[model samples]
Target: MEPVPLAVGLAALLGLSSAVLEVHVGQTSVVSIKGQQAILPLWYTSYSNSRPFVSCLLERRDPTKHLQVLTYIDGKSKVDEKYFKHRVGFLYPMPSPNVSIAINNTQEDDSGQYMCTVNLGDESSTDGRNIGLVNLTVLVPPSSPTCKIQGTPHVGGNVTMSCKSLSGKPSPMYHWRRTGPSFQVFFAPVQDLSKGTLTLTNLTTDMSGTYICNASNSAGYSNCTITLEVTPAFNAAVVAGAVVGALIGLGLILLFALQMFVYRRKKKDVQEEMANEIKEDAVAPKTLSWAKSPGSDVVSKNGTLSSMNTAQDHKLYPSKPPSDTASVTTATGSMVAYKPPYNNPRGGTLTPTPSLSSQSLPLYFPPTVNGIHCHHANVPVHRNAQHRTNGAQPQAPRQEHTLPPGLTSSTLTRMGAVPVMVPAQSQAGSLV
Candidate 1:
């Protein structure tokens, strides 16, 4: 390489600053932990131990106060006037008369600044004076950080949290928050890298939200965040279920009450209709007429069943009036047995009174078999009630009649069910 420029060479040498030079009071420079009396290397862009320096300039960053520092140099106590003595007057403001800096003891008062300046008559230059301490520090290992919460708890069971640095000279600290609040029912704390764990216990809905964990060391600083949540409990749900069940039961009770009211109303309506029909029939005119009829079962217009009759026998059959035996024990309730009129073919005459017992007989017994009917009252049963055969009546003609399906028990005397064929070709309602 070509010969380095003089200024470049000199600047490079100053850059190799030694801790043995003079105390460093500049803002960005550093000193050792035991640097109270520290001597920092002095760097000159154009001066060295070999080359003579002209003067030093002392000025604060803001030089408003106009401080005037003294002038001095180290190692000038030798008896050679050529090396130590200065013939010129002292610099503008001298804190003390000329004294060699090497032999002088330094104090906090002496710690301010001094300028060592020289004059080479033909050239003039200046160097900055760095003075005043910033108290630099060399680092050792750091201490552990401590932690705590902000308040005891705000809500009844909720808590607040935070943390701090305890032993480190540089103050290492941390913070803490929980896990995810929006998704899960539980949460965990995230501790700072250099601090103790952070935890939240007995969480509730009040506990849901964000949390923070902060970590700081002498090296750097960082932080993180977490969220928390809580689940609903059984006690809350029980009351809700009970209220719903009670409402349903109350509705069922109301429906049952409405049905009972409707049933009773229908029963009263039917009873009123039957009572009105009875009144009309009782006011109808009475008549005395007679006619003959075949044994035919009669069905009353009032929906009652009666006995059977026959035309070939020309029998005089008269139905008795209502007797004291009108009382009936029925499957449903008490019923009344009423008397029906009678018919005779012999000159429309009434049967003479015989000394008949007060006991009245049934008009017709039901058919013994499928097609055979018997007139139970037409034949006089003189046989002893104890010595009677299963055949209660003698057989007549073979006029076959059959009962409706499943009506074997309901086939009463055919005559009572038989219509009075007198009004032939009349409408069914008109005959009734």
Candidate 2:
């Protein structure tokens, strides 16, 4: 019981002595700009006779981690070579009560909580106020921003204007305004400050102007500018009318082409028909006529007498007169009219008679009279030869006849000789 009371009294005394030594640092947070320096103020009070050991540390409140910044023991000081290195140093030398530190060339990543602690030499006491805290902030100004317009800037339409900054320490706020043709400045009705967007609805020609966007933060601000142009809406009636007119013109052109093609085809057909008709009319029928002989009568092999006068020949033939005529003397001393050489209507020349002479007579005469088949012996015509030699009257040759089995010459003459109907041959201009 006596030893326990002594231990209790010793613990009370130690607590009282530990409470006398304390570490102090600025309570307010420090603000800094990037690429500049910042100072952390620190001090301490100690009742002990000897100097105290001090330590400075960095605390990350977000991730809840601790890092050693520096430590001071005795008269010598050491900095964390890996983390602080040349970037951090004590404002005051070692063995001094002040343990303030300055950070050079600060960056955004260096901003965080820092702590200072002091301990008496070899005390190992837990009951005391020997800790201090500080907060630091590094600010970065807003960089140059880009301005853009989205959607069609047309009358009765809507559009969106946007601004953006690539870098800033704190997120920047945005504002939008427009400068008219007369240089009048006005703010947009619909805009988002944080998102950096401005919206314009039911646009008009009056809305055409230069637009400005400003991005700002605690450090500084930057701005960008763009232009918008609105135009009148198109007229629906005029567009429709133009389209209809073009379609009508195209239809007319197609109709004209079709008509021309049909007209050409019909004309060609008519020409072909006319040509066929001309070819059909070009052919004419051929006729045959028996030439008349004066003061002579034709006798058949049947002892039939057929006398054909000029009137009777024309009545029987009833065809167009021949174009050319020639007189020929027969072996009986009679002049017979015949056609001369001429072109046949179809093609080729008519079969011409051979040269007449006293030695030979025609074997077959063309255009026989009344279907009579009369044969004359090849007796030389004495009249023609005699006439040619001495120009004297020559005697006519005597005719011989082979009478039919049932007919006589006297009976044939009394009955006026059966008129032989000689039909024309089928071939054009052929001789028999």
**Which candidate has the highest TM-score of all?**
2
State every prediction's TM-score relative to the real structure: 0.23, 0.49
Q: Superposing every Cα of model 2 onto the true structure, what RMSD results?
A: 18.4
Q: How do the residues 1-432 of candidate 2 rate in per-residue lDDT, one tens digit apiece?
A: 133234345646777563456666655488888778999887765545577788888888666567888888876888888767899988877776677789988888788988888887745444546787889999888889999889977689999988999999898989887765746433545888888999889998898998888899988899999989886667444677889999999999999999999999999999999999999889784322322222124332221211222223322221222212323333343533333444455453433222122222113232333665222222223222343332222333433323445556444433333223221122333211
Summarize candidate 1's per-residue lDDT along 6-34 as a digit string, tens digits.
Answer: 43455467774321122222233433321
Q: Which runs of model 1 end up more than 4 angstroms from their true locations?
A: 1-303, 307-346, 350-384, 390-432
**What range of 10 consecutive residues in model 1 has the weakest lDDT sum?**
423-432
Count of backbone collisions within predicted model 2: 1
Candidate 2 achieves a global lDDT of: 0.63
Return the lDDT, model 2, position 207. Answer: 88
Candidate number of the best lDDT: 2
* True-structure RMSD, every candidate: 21.3, 18.4
